[model samples]
Target: MIKTKCFFCKKSYTIDYSDSQYQKIKANPKAYYVCKKCNESMQREAQSTTGLDMDVIDKYDKFLR
Candidate 1:
């Protein structure tokens, strides 16, 4: 069975689709498993935000490029 548990809020849904949906989401295929509520909250935050900043090690990773 496909687990639909959103890694963010840990909310389980009736449909199990995230794992199988990784390819359809983005070019890198990095899966962010977030349930509906948390997903909506993140969406709101993203919409209100501007330039993104990489945290610590993430900054180093970008420094390589």
Candidate 2:
């Protein structure tokens, strides 16, 4: 498992995966894994902040959250 800190919440979490899954996630520089609560909270916050549906934002942007 790799320990990662959430860019928004500043909380640390672990990612446990097989070698193939790890490689795939590692290949993507923008890959982020946040805890379930944070993910839900961020989505709601994004919608409220932008005054638009969550679909309008590009979830892949590392800096968006």
- Whose TM-score is greatest here? 2
10 residues in a row with least lDDT, candidate 1: 20-29
- For model 1, which pairs clash? none
Q: What global local distance difference test value does model 1 have?
A: 0.52
**Model 1 TM-score, 2 decimals:** 0.41
For model 2, give the 10-residue run with minimal summed lDDT.
18-27
Query: Where does model 1 exceed 4 Å of error?
Result: 16-32, 51-65
lDDT of candidate 1 over 1-45, digit per residue (tens) = 333456776776444344344444443334555655776577558
Number of colliding residue pairs in model 2? 0
What is the Cα-based TM-score of model 2? 0.44
- Tens-digit per-residue lDDT, 1-65, candidate 2: 67666666878766667432345456663576566577779878987888877554565654444
* TM agreement with the true structure for every prediction: 0.41, 0.44
